[model samples]
Target: MSKNEKYSHESYLEYQGKYKGIWGWLFSTDHKRIGLLYLYSIAFFFVVAAILGLLIRIELIAPGPTIMDAQTYNGLFTVHGIIMIFIVVIPGLGAVFGNFFLPIMIGAKDVAFPRLNLLSWYIFILGAILAVASQFAGGGAPDTGWTFYVPYSSTSSTNVIFALTAAFILGFSSILTGINFIVTIHRLRAPGMGWFKMPLFPWSLYATAWIQVLATPIVGITLLMVIAERVLQIGFFDPALGGDPLLFQHLFWIYSHPAVYIMILPAMGVVTEIFPTFSQKPVFGYGAIVISSIAIAAVGYFVWGHHMFTTGISYWSRWFFSFLTFIVAIPSAIKVFNWISTMYGGSIDLKTPLLYAISFIFLFMIGGFTGLTLGALATNVHLHDTSFVVAHFHYIIFGGMGFAFFAGIHYWYPKMYGRMYNIKLANIAWGVLFTGFNVLYFPLFIIGIQGMPRRYFDYLEQFHTGHFISTIGAIILIIGIFMMLFNLIYYRHRGAVAPSNPWKGVTLEWQIESPPTHENFEEIPEIKTPPYLFKKES
Candidate 1:
């Protein structure tokens, strides 16, 4: 096929194909377009979930009901957790950025299963629709929380079945995406690009994909069992019938725990890419970083029992899980040290992306330290169901993974859209988000230690002040988020045209045109040097 002249002069945003307008994007098999599909869809759900989170905060701002009743508050938070965990964070980086750049980084035209790539997205959307639809169509919205724990989940009159079904479908979508990535990485690396020569982002995705493939089915089957128990009354989780509730926790966390790595690994991959580019050095300990990614995925599976310590498990099991949890942190700390070492003597750019990456380290450290507290037997007994657990989780997921995602978006914004956002505004947004995030969740940590329980619609008078402060922080954080989103949207159309290699990134994707062509390269480029080589531009 002859290359169109427009492929050189125009971005993918302007390139026309067999179908015109919406239909073109909706049905197109291009990995980049499919990635954007995930981006836009995920962004929509993120906003919805964010709003729900804000409402939850507002309701907790005062001791008494501020916006909704107890039942409504419970339902809202349940939906919020479901949407955020399943729809946003778990698939956040891999589905969006990974799908967009993995093939290009590896010098392939697209993912090995291009059609299946599109199918995975469709399934994700369908699952999201079912989850939301349950709120309006069923007996009521689910009140079992995102975990959908037993007895309560089994007995809830609300839409537990619909929520379970939604989770099940989403798991299928995740598994397909994982399979596509694994096959693409194994089969499609450019000539001479050996296993060690591949970029860190793809390596992280490789590790995450394996976890997704191996671990997600456990949750899929577990959720299916929940649905069966609810419908068929088979009594798997309900003690009144014949099954053990603790068994449900065991099965659930088996997948859910590894699912944590699925959410954070790609985010770490994003940070890995950004550090070397902005710092203008090869990532410190490249082999260590790669091994750490694989190690985290492997060790993550064995630590699920830490989440179940509050339940009555064998004494040895609790200590065993706690030990495994601490062991997982060693590799995590190694990655952190390597990142810091990479920036030690380098000419750092201090761009918005790096700012977010730095912030991720700080926030993730706090989350990690607090996680150790929970991993201990005595501390887990005190903090397991308190707002402390909630605070630590947000610090890791929102503060860690969420910051890394923002870093990826800013670092790749120019490449993805062929334009640059206002740098000053981007930095300002980052500052606000960073400060507001700490203020919001830090107060929760204080109150949680003061004995505030989680998931309570109302709080004790002693905790009211902390709740009030957190609510204000939530508003500020939302403002910063909106500002950042607005800046990106506004600049996509009007911002200055970007250079192909805006970040001076050495990855294969940076060698191609910005917003790369439908067929990424005219001919697959031969790889010679390692991926992280930082050459001084003449």
Candidate 2:
């Protein structure tokens, strides 16, 4: 516990148990431990989902239902999408980074409601287990896709009811975490840390929290209605019972669409933090970036129709959603521009975090531009369910959000663990990931454009070349991910001794001892400027 002594990982757990026990890990309210728990759980889900991804990619290598039957393929993509979106991305926002760093970043003792934060995590785990258990209960996981669109969902042979119910449970966890973060940020700022003075990372969390609180409930009720139709046969979305299937699309996208923003906004926030610090300059458009984040969250709600453009939505609604979709990209573009501007004529440090951040901008740009093409109703008719859409999204989510998550992880790994990862290995891992990710995802773009649909185990011979190339990419990509994990996990104890500020960035976390203490700070420090305002010591 002393500042000079190395923090024992076992010691932290021992202190936690002496004070609380199994109940401590289960019922305690330490944000760092909670964050660590999230870190562990989400990474577990990520691996499972990633394996499913590899399976899907492998099946398509030669085409024609190589692995599982069509029905099983349906289940694979369904569970893959469900676990990745609801279990992995949603909980990750508040549970992992927010839990561990939000208080540390803003100089608070804990979140405004620590117990509620703990409760949120349990609810999330419970919901994840319930969703997984559905695979065994009735029909072995729902095949109605992650969205669980109505008529198919209502009449599907799979355990649609159980799956929808689990999703509803996760929604509550998302809402509570969002609410906890909002209240904490609003009420818990340290002295002299005005709103503008707070770090961009917390500001991004603040924006993301609003999206969670306001948008998540819609999905909660929407899923409940889906369950109602399946169980009680109330028929809100069942056309046979005086309901409209398209209405299901509307209500579903109402939540599902903004849900994507919830995943990416906090990521954008993390990138915002990294760009300035590594560039060693003030954020080029601080006020503009903050406003755009809020704008993206606000405007993100109206564009759900874009996802349903191929579902026979009215032309006017399609046009409106298209316009809104294009408008949404403006804010995101501003962020990218601002990041590049921050690097303009500045001291840009080519460290691991900076490498990931720059990669995020590149991948995000491709995703955003391609999304515009899909948003256009005319172009979307061809690409609606194709690999183009798949490629665009992976680039955005995997390349954009996943990379940002790694960037944050690498940027803070030393501070989080009180140890340094092998810099050579770290760079090598990043190189592998960056190379393999593009190899894995980029060819799907070509395959999709040549008329290959996503989730199809059978494809025409014309797409074979692209599919073959994509498989090679997947192998390399997995290697990259494994290397990154090995260094973080196996190298934790044996890595070089990390100083308090290995990156030499100006954040409150760097001001404290590595791995932090039981309370995060012995004495919470006061900040007079943004966390990334790099100033050389005199």
- The best candidate by lDDT is 1
What would the per-residue lDDT of candidate 1 be over residues 331-414, giving only the tens digit for each residue? 999999999998988889999999999999999999999999999899889887989999999999998889999999999998
The stretch of ten residues in a row with the least summed lDDT in candidate 2 is 9-18
Best by TM-score: 1
Query: How far in Å is the alpha carbon of 210 misplaced in model 1?
Result: 0.6
Tell me each candidate's TM-score. Answer: 0.98, 0.96
Tell me each candidate's RMSD, in Å, in order: 2.8, 2.4
Estimate, for each residue in 1-538, the C-alpha lDDT of model 2 and write its tens digit.
2234565444234455445666667666888878888889899989888888888788878868787888878888888888888998876755788888899888987899988988888888898888877766877768888889778898998988888888999999999989998998899888778888888888888988888899889889988988888789897999999999999888888888888888898899888888877887778888898899889989998999998888888889988999999999999999999999999987888998899999999999999999999988889998989999999999988888899899989888887777777777888999999998899889999889888888676889989888888878888888899999998997677777677777776767777777777677767677666655667621
Q: Give the alpha-carbon lDDT of every model.
A: 0.92, 0.84
Please give the lDDT score for candidate 1. Answer: 0.92
* Candidate 1 residue-wise lDDT at 524: 93
Give the lDDT of residue 285 in candidate 1. 97
